[model samples]
Target: MRERVGVYPGTFDPVTNGHLDVIQRAARLLDRLAVGVAINAGKGPVFPLEERVELVRAETAPIAAATGCAISVVPFEGLLVTFAREQGAEMIVRGLRAVSDFDYEYQMAGMNHRLDPGVETVFLTASETNQFISSRFVKEIARLGGDISSFVPQLTLERTLARVRDQAGE
Candidate 1:
């Protein structure tokens, strides 16, 4: 087995429980998992790249430790396939929560295959409990002063809400 490695790339402005679920499930399928945090300067991020990376790293540490699968927190600056190739990953894991995301993600997966036929994408359906969880939704809830502690980890919830409040001038 040539080291079953997978790369899960996303913006992950604030890591949510849904993302955690995907990572946990994907980790089981690979010997090493790379969660690539894509930094697109064109689309401004609520949490800076460093802070986002740290939050994801801290939250995923326990899982990585338990699974004995290395979790690398990388900043993706190019095409996702390119990043996956650089990391030596043979699979690109995608988390699908709704049908709406399918069209786009399917297209992306096809494009990735075209780029590197060796790299394949595996889609993991979101658990029913996490079907409604999204970073954008979490941020909106926190922005309105609603508690999102139930949706995300305590540390992440606190930091995300604080960031939202700061951005909203509240």
Candidate 2:
């Protein structure tokens, strides 16, 4: 059987537990997985692309080690479908938090299909505990001095808080 390569693309402003859940799940399903840190300048991410990729790499290391799934964190710009094709990924894994995410993801899936008919998209529902957690919300909570340790990994939370403090000149 051919190795199944999958791409999970996201901005990953901060590597949250919810994102980790999806990564763990997808890692088990594919022979190899690539976490693509999208360079979305439009979103104005709090963490730079390099930092985002490093955070994801740190958080996902154990998952990859335990599952024996080859994984790499990479930065990509331009169309997701194009990136997936370039990575030789046959599947694009996405995490769906709720019904609200479906419409946008569904449309993107269709567009990806049109762009590359060979690559398929698979959506994994976020774990119940992580369903309400999002990077944006976590960042908001951190910026407002709320505890966000439960939502994000320890290292990620530390780095995010440090960055926030630095930006505030604290």
Candidate 3:
């Protein structure tokens, strides 16, 4: 049987719980999953690419074990469809947190399909408890000394707080 491979690409600035929620669920549906850490310098990431990739790998380890799906963390840049192709991904997994996300995801799906007809885009809805969690909001909350414990994993929370503190010269 041909193994099913899926790619979940994201900047994952701080690896929020919402992102993990999608990844865990997506892993269940594929034989192999590639967590693509995008080097989107335009987003001005707090954790940097290598750190983001490491954090994602660490965070997804348990999920990969639990789902018995092989998950590999890889750094990617440029067009996501191209990355998907390079990773031999039959589909691209994306997380939708709200109605507002649908429009953009829908258009991107269409474009991706046009670019590579063989690959499909799949959308996973974020868990209700994590639906509102975003890396940007988590960073903001941590920067201002607000509690973000509910939004990300423990290690991620620690790193985010430390990074924010460093950025603030605290």
Candidate 4:
């Protein structure tokens, strides 16, 4: 039988609890999960690629260690579908938190399917506790000096706030 490998691609400036939940659940469904950190020069990231990758690696290590799932941290520079094909991933795991996200993700899934006919997409709903979490929202909240401890992991919250502060020159 062919291995069920999944590719979870995202910017993941700082991996959050929500992302962790998706990765943990996806790991159970697939033999291997490649967490692809996408790099888009058009969209300037608050954290550098290395820092973002390290954060994701650190946050996901425990789950990978426990589940014995082959987890890899790689950068996706070009087309995401192409990257998934290169990694031999049969599925692309995505998290949907709202109707708006569903619409966007659905469109992207279609595009990916067109690019790679063999690859499929699996959508996972965000846990109720994380339905309100989003990187944009988190960054804006921290930029406004608001607390976001409830929405993100403690370690990630601190790092996010520091990055926001630095970016804002506060």
lDDT leader: 2
lDDT of 3 by residue, 1-170 (tens): 99999999999999989999999999889999999999989999999899999999999999999999999999998999999999999899999999999999999999999999999999999989988988889888898899999889998888888899899995
Residue 55 Cα positional deviation in candidate 4, in Å, after optimal superposition: 0.2
Write the residue-wise lDDT of candidate 1 on 72-169 in tens digits.
Answer: 99988989989999999999999999999899999999999999999999999999999989988888788888879878987898899788878888
The candidate, 1 or 4, that scores higher on lDDT is 1
How many pairs collide in each candidate, listed in order? 0, 0, 0, 0
The 0-to-1 C-alpha lDDT of every candidate, in the order given, reads 0.90, 0.94, 0.93, 0.86
Residue 126 in model 4: lDDT: 91
> Listing every candidate in turn, what is its Cα RMSD in Å to the true structure after a full C-alpha superposition?
1.2, 0.8, 0.9, 1.5
| lDDT digits (tens) for residues 57-170 of candidate 4 | 887888898888888888889988889989999899999988889989999999999998899999999988887788777777778989888766777777888888788885
lDDT string, candidate 2, 1-170, tens digits: 89999999999998899999999999999999999999998998999898898899999999999999999999999999899988999999999999999999999999999999999999999999999999889988988889998999899989999998887885
Give the clash count for model 1. Answer: 0
Candidate 1 TM-score over all chains jointly: 0.96
Q: Report the lDDT of model 2 for residue 14.
A: 89
